[model samples]
Target: MPAMRFFVFALSLAVTSPLLAEEAKPGSPPPERIVEQKIPPLTPPDHELDLLFAQLKKERNPQAARLIADRITSSLFYSGSATVDMLMGNARKATEEKRFGAALDFLDQITLLAPGYAEGWNARASLHYQMGNFPKAMADTAHVLKLEPRHLGALSGLAAVLSQSGRDQQALAALEAYLDRYPADRDAQKRAIDLMIKLDGQRT
Candidate 1:
């Protein structure tokens, strides 16, 4: 059977363990320690993003709320070029077909052509994750964050990779970051709660 990339968790960091490096903080001593510190639980710190998410949460119907959020999310994926759009469409079809190698080929072209586009980086990140190439996926995720720090999708993808890689605490923080922007993601909420329970158990 072909290998499958598994994504079962959410984005984040600034943890207190020696396992993963702490998130860089202002004047953080080299290799800062945050061991035993609880993960920070702040929402996505962007006013515009908060407002959009607020609007999404206020919708009465669940599907409607998802639709609104989807629309908002969709807008983030657009890259205003027909060629890039065509390449991206092809990449999407390849991914759906499980032709991962082909999908990666297309994604490579996308990043090559639109190095500044966050969607290209995000797409590549996702494809790498599906291939179970966590380090490469993470490198792309970093690029996405650099290009668009408000990208919850990228953050969520990062969290999934972290969680599956056995970095539960890092996964918890990343999920919190994702939920800060998308509190309506029920699956993520459940996973975050589960991680909290598991982490708590380890403490005693």
Candidate 2:
């Protein structure tokens, strides 16, 4: 499969500030440690899945929603561009509903259907990271880097996953690589700096 590129450049990390590297204040525990959590895949494509998509699009009528989404998917599957977008849309809807497992499944489908689409892999990586599956997330990010060497999103994702996984040095390196390519990425740069300090303090 082709490398998956990240959408880091398109993401707004400012929405959530990065945690600094300082020691936790007195009486406070360190940041919560995240571990990989295995999630079972949802049932294969069905009328209910189509209805869910339609409901997400503001369609109130269940019957109509299922019909429309099914029709769209039928035509979308054969076209790479459309298929990617369709799958992405479904993933987004699943995420909005806090259905992380389903979102991952949708992303998985995207990768299977359109392995060459950098965006598909990137999206999958994001979902995996959100689920605390750092190893899987990192692997997907690497795939993105292979497809687009300068993908800021993948670089940032790699950095985040590495930091969380206790591979701070590697994370710092990935972040530095991203900053070198995007000098104006103040948010990402700040995150990298904060994570570096945090990791360094751990060593000291």
Q: Best candidate, lDDT-wise? A: 1
Worst 10 residues of 1 by lDDT: 1-10
Collision pairs in model 1:
10-159, 10-175, 11-159, 11-174, 11-175, 12-174, 16-34, 16-35
Please provide, for model 1 over 1-204, each residue's C-alpha lDDT reduced to its tens digit, 9 standing for 90 to 100: 010112222122213333556577898677645346443321233465567677765665556767767866776666666778899999999999999999999999989977877888889999999898998998898777766665778878887888888988877877777666666778878999999999999998
C-alpha lDDT of all candidate models, in order = 0.74, 0.64
Evaluated with TM-score, which candidate comes out highest?
Answer: 1
Instruction: State TM-scores per candidate.
Output: 0.71, 0.58
Off by over 4 Å in 2: 1-80, 198-204
Deviation in angstroms for 61 in model 2? Answer: 48
Q: Tens digit of lDDT per residue, candidate 2, span 31-114?
A: 675444432222223464345443435654546644654553343233335556787899999988989989988899988866
